[model samples]
Target: MGGELTWGLPVILYLFLAGVGAGVGTVSASVLLRGGGGGFGGDHFRLARIGALLSPLPVIVGTTLIVFELGQPSRAFNLFKVINLSPMNIGSWLLLVFICTSVLYALAFLPSFMPEMKHLSDRLERVRRGFAWVNVPMGIGVAVYTGVMLGAMPSRPLWNSPILALLFLISALSTGVAAIILLRAIFRRKSADPATEQGYHQSAYLLTASDVMLIGFELMVIFLFIMFAHLTIGNMKYAVSIILPGGDMAMMFWVWVVLIGLLLPGLAELAYVLPRLLYHRHYAAPVAVEVLVSIGVLIGGFMLRYVIVVAGQVTGPMGI
Candidate 1:
C-alpha cells in the first residue's frame, strides 16, 4: 500500500455515478421492453421515461470528472487511438457508446412531449424498443467494467476478487432503483384520476420489491467477498483484514456500507412490500420514508466505492 492515495474523490465518484447510470439505463430499458414500448404518455411508462431521461447525464458528468481528474482532457482521446482488450480502453469505449445510445434512447421518448409530432413519436417508439435491447447489455457492461477495472489490478489484493464485479453490479442496480424511487416520490403528481394515481403506486411497489431483491443479493455478495479473501493465503488474507472487525476500515464498511446502505433500506422496503404482497394492502409508503431509504441506499453505494478504493490503496502493493 502507498502512504499517499493515488486516486481521490473524483475517481471514487466516477465509479459510483457510472454504476448508477448503468443501472438506471439498464432498468429503464427493461421496463420499456416489458411494457411493449409505447409512447411515454401513459402512466405505465412513466417510470421508463424518468429512467431514460435520467440515465445518460450521470455517466456524462462522471466521465467529465474523470477527464478532469486526468489533468489533461485532450489526452483522453488517446484511449480511442489504440483499441485492445485492456480494461481502460474497453471501459472508455463502453462509456462512449453507452452515452450515445442512452441519449438516443432518451430522445426517442421525448417526441411524446410534442403533441403535434404524434406520428413521429409513434415511429420513434419502435426505434426506442430496439434501443432498449442494446442499452440493457451495454449498461450491464458499463457496470461490470467499473469493478473489472479495479479487480484487474492484482497488486491491490482487496480489489482482486472476482466477486467485486458482481457486488458492484448488484449495488449499481440497487442504487439505480433507489434513484428512480427517489425521483418518482419527489416529482409524482397528485392526479385527480384514480387510475393515474394507482399507476404511480404500482410503480413504487414494483421498484421497492426489486430493490429488496437487489439488496439481498448485495448482502450475500458481501459475505462471499469477505469469506473469499479471508480464506485466501498471505497478502490476500492480510489485505482483506482492513474491512474485517478491528481493522482500519471495519467501521466504515460495517456501518456505512452494510448497515446504513443495505440493511436499513432492505428491511424498510420489505416491510412496505410484504403488506402489499401478502395482505393486498394498498402500497402507500410515506414520501419521507421513501426519500430517506433511497438516500440511504445511494449513500451506501457511494461509501462502498469509497471504502473499496481507499482500502485497495491503503493495504499494500503485495510482493509478487
Candidate 2:
C-alpha cells in the first residue's frame, strides 16, 4: 500500500453516480409500469417521470468521468475489441448498453414536457416501458457492478465481501428514492388541486416509508459486511478493523455513514410517518424536514462509497 492507486476518486464518483442513476432509473421504470397505462403525461406519472428524466444525467456524467480517468478516451472503445469474462470488459459493455437504453428511456418521456412531441411520445410509451424492462435489470447490474468491481480486487480484503454487491445495490436504491422524494418535494410544493395535493401527500408518505425499509435493509447488509470481515482471518479481519469502534476510519464510518446516512433518515421518516399511520392524521411532514433527510441520505451515500474506497486502498495486503 505504498504507490498511488490506479483507481481513485474518479472511480469512486463513477460508482456513486452510476448507483444513483441505476436506483432511480429502476424506480422510475417501476413507477411507469405501474402507472396503469396512463402513458407518460398522466399526473400519476409525474414523480416517476422525474426519476426517468434524471436517470441518464448522472450516469452520463459518471461515464464521462470514467472516460477521463481512462486518460486516453479511445481506450474505452477498445473494450469492445474483445469479449472475455473480466469485470472491466463486462462492465464496459453493461454500461454501454445501459447508457443507450437509458437515453431512449429518458427521451421517450420528452412528450411529458414538450407538447410538440405528444403524438410521438404517446406511441413511445410502450417502447419506453419496454426499455424499462431492460433498464431496471441493467440499472441493477450497474449498481452491483460497482461493488463487484471492488470485490474483484482480490488483494483488497475490505472489498472482498460478497455482501459488498448487495450493500451497494441497496444503497443505490435508497439514494435513488431519496433523490426523487427530494425533487418532488421541491417541485410539487403545494398542488393547486386538493385531490392532487392529497395524492402527493400519500405518495410522499409511501415513498418515505419505502426509503425507511431500504435504509433498514442497507443497515443489515452493512452489519453483515462488517461482521463477515471481522469474523474472518488475517487481512480480512485487519481490513474490517479499520472501521471498527477505535479503528482509523471508525469515526467517519459511524458518524457519517451510519448516523447521518442510514439512521437519521430512518428516524426522521418514522417520526413523521408513524404518527400519521397511528393517529390517522392528514398532514404531510414539513418540506424542509423531508428535504433535509433526502440531502442527508445522498450525502451519506457518497460518504459510504468514499470511506469504502479510501479505506480499502489504505488497509490492503500490507505490501501492495
Candidate 3:
C-alpha cells in the first residue's frame, strides 16, 4: 500500500470543526425553541442570545479552513455551477445552504444584546422565527451531510459506513451542547437568576448525558463498521486494517480516536450521571464533570475525522 501523506490534516480538521460549529449552532437553536417555562429554568432568551452570537464564528472558520484544504479554492465554484446528484455536488449545495441559514440565525440572535437595536432586533427575531422553520432542517442536513460525504465514498473502506453520517450528526449536536454549557459557565455571572443558573446547569447536565449516550452509540456503530469492513473479502478489508494498532495511523486510531476521543468522555459522563443517582444538590460535582466530559468529547470528535481521513488514503486498494 502506498500514497502521499497529505490528505490527512485537512479532511480530519474539516470534519471535526464543521461538526463542532454546526452542533453548537443547532443546540443554541434548540435551547431557544425550548426556553422559557417549557424546559429548564433561566433567562432562556439571554442564554440563547449568547449562544447565537458565538455559534457561527466556529462554523464560518471551519468552512473557510475546509475550502482551503480542497486545494484550489477557485475550483470549488464548479460545485454550484452544476446541479449533478453527486455527493460532492450535494454537499457543496448543502454546506452553502447551511452556512447562509446559520449566518442568518446567528445574526438574528444579536438584537437582544443592544438597547438601541431592540426594536429592530424584535423584527429580525420575527424574521428569524420564520427562518428557523427552514434552518432546523438545513442544520440537520449539514450535520448529516458531514457523515454522508464520507459514507458516499465507496472506494474508501473507512468512509463506507452508512452510520457515519449519523455519527457525525450526533457529534455535532454533542459538541454544540457542550459549547453552550461552557459558555454559560464562563458568562451569566452578572445578572443570572439563581433558578436560571441552576436550570442551565441541569439542562447542560442532561444534554451532556444525552451526548454521552449518543457517543456510545456512535462508538458501537464504529466498532461494527470496522468489523464489517475487516470481515469483507478484498481491498475493503485490506484498507480497514491499515489503522489497526500497528498499522500506519495506529497511534491516531487507538490512542486519539478510541481512548481519548470515545472512552474517556464516556467514563467522565458516567462519573457525573452516577452521582446524580445517589443524591441531589450534587450540582458542583456534576457540573464540573460535565465540563471535563465536554472537553474529552470535543477531542474525540477531532480524532474521528483525523483517523478516517488519514487512514483512507494510506492503504492500497487492496493488500498488495
Stretches off by above 4 angstroms in model 2 are 1-3, 35-37, 40-43, 114-119, 276-280, 318-320
The best-first sequence of candidates by lDDT reads 1, 2, 3
Q: Model 1 residue 176 lDDT?
A: 94
Which number leads on TM-score?
1
lDDT of 3 by residue, 1-320 (tens): 46676665766777777777777767667666655412222445655666667766777787788788877887878778889877767877877887787788777766656778767876676665665566667777778887887777666767777877877887777777667666666664534566756666566556666666777887887787788878888877878887775677878778877788778877777666666756754544344565676677777778777777777766546543
The TM-score of candidate 1 is 0.96
Q: Write model 2 residue lDDT over 1-320, tens digit each, in one string.
A: 35687689998898889989899998888777774436653645776778888988989999999899987887788899998888778888888988999888888877768877778878887888899889988999989888888898779989988889899999999999998988888886566888888767766876787898899999999999998888888889988898999888899999999999999889999888887878988758888998999999999999999999988988876554
Instruction: Note the residue pairs that clash in candidate 3.
Output: 23-172, 23-176, 24-176, 147-165, 261-300
- RMSD (Cα, Å) of candidate 1? 1.5
Best by lDDT: 1
**Model 3 Cα shift for residue 112 (angstroms):** 1.2
Q: Output the lDDT of residue 165, model 2.
A: 89
- Per-candidate Cα RMSD to the true structure, in Å, reads 1.5, 2.0, 3.1
Better of 1 and 2 by TM-score: 1
Better of 1 and 2 by lDDT: 1
Report how far residue 45 has shifted in candidate 2, in Å: 0.5
Error of 2 at 302 (Å): 0.5
- Model 1 over residues 254-318: C-alpha lDDT tens digits? 99999999999999999999999999999988899999999999999999999999998999655
